[model samples]
Target: MKLATYNVNGVNGRLDVLLRWLDEASPDVVCLQELKTPDARFPLKEIEKAGYGAVWQGQKSWNGVAILGRGRKPILTRRSLPGDPDDLHSRYIEAAVEGMVIGCLYLPNGNPSPGPKFDYKLEWFERLARHAAELLALDVPVVLAGDYNVIPTALDVYKPERWAEDALFRTEVRDAYKQIVDQGWTDAIRRLNPDARIYTFWDYVRNAYGRDAGLRLDHLLLSPSVAGRLRSAGVDRHVRGWQHTSDHAPVWVELSDD
Candidate 1:
């Protein structure tokens, strides 16, 4: 199956670009982030018309997440992350699709280090790690996919030195990412193309895409059982060049049928 993840940035604003990509790519399962719309305005009609049934958790003008299953309804598993009840951001959603447990997330973009936001970012990562360990214990075919908002390593960003002080590239953030991956999850893209300078996101500023100044912030991490099925993985880089498109391009992995 072709399983993909995309941070739409704004579901309604970029509806056209999304639909176009859906038609062109036709992934069997999709994990979407940054819907940036409230639940009431999720545009279910438009998405259904495009031949995919979806389950989404949305928030107005900010973080949101969803999972789409082609020709089938995604069985809703969980709507929010488990660690906090007061944390009311729509950053995560999970579902069962095509015999796999799919977790879609939009991790916090903690800017301005040495502050509350950055602390929250680390807190959230730890919560996610705790929950991820639970999922690993289940030993099912699981895929945790989304816009992680983390430049995992110096190799992931265009200029490591320039982003040294940035929250996304900070040492703490990268270490958190590593701890999660160390918990028996495979970084699908990196596993396949270890030496390649692959990127899944580019800023819509200063001709970043043109200059190839990008970051691999979006990721699809697979469990051991599913990792063995990983046949191929790639980024739809050209889609980022589309007019009025999101800063993030789609990232995907093709898994062999069980």
Candidate 2:
């Protein structure tokens, strides 16, 4: 199966580009983030017309996620991440697609660090770790794919030293991601092409895309069962240069049939 993840930034604003990419790529399953729309205004009919069924959790103006499965309805597993009853951000959504438990996540940006936002980011990572552990226990095919909002290593960013103060590249964030991977999940993209500079997000400012200045914040983490089927992985870099495109391009991985 071909699985992909993308942070569309805003579904309404990037509908055309998104649809075009979807048609061209034809991934069997896609995880989407940053829809920035309310559930009622999600344009469900438009998506359905494109030959995919989705289960989404959305809120107004920020942080939303969804899973779209080709030729099948995605069974909603959870609309919100567990362990935080009062957290209202629409940052997580999970579904069962083609026997794989797939999770789409839009982790907090946590910019201007060394404050409450950064603290929240760490706490959220802890919660995700707990949830991920539970999924690992299932021992079934699982894929956690999305914009983690983290730069896992210095190689994953354009200028490591320049981003030391940035929340995305902070040591704490990297450590949290390391803990998750240490728990037996495979970083699909890195595993497939180690020692290569593959990036999925480029900043709109400073002509980042033109200069190939980007970060590999978006990812696909696979359980052992699913990891064994990994065939290939890549970033659709050209998508970031399209008209009215998001800061993020799509990242995808192909796996053998279960």
Q: Which lDDT values do the candidates have, in the order given? A: 0.95, 0.93
* Model 1 misplacement above 4 A: none
* Clashes per candidate (backbone, < 3 Å): 0, 0
Residue-by-residue lDDT tens digits, candidate 1, 1-258? 999999999999999999999999999999999999999999899999999999999999999999999999899999999989999999999999978999999999899897999999999999999999999999899999999999988889999999998989999999999999999999999999998999999998899999999999999999999999999999999999999999999999999989
Summarize candidate 2's per-residue lDDT along 153-203 as a digit string, tens digits. 988999899999999999999999999999999999999889998899999
* Local distance difference test, candidate 1: 0.95
Cα-based TM-score, every candidate: 0.99, 0.99
Q: Which candidate has the top score in lDDT?
A: 1
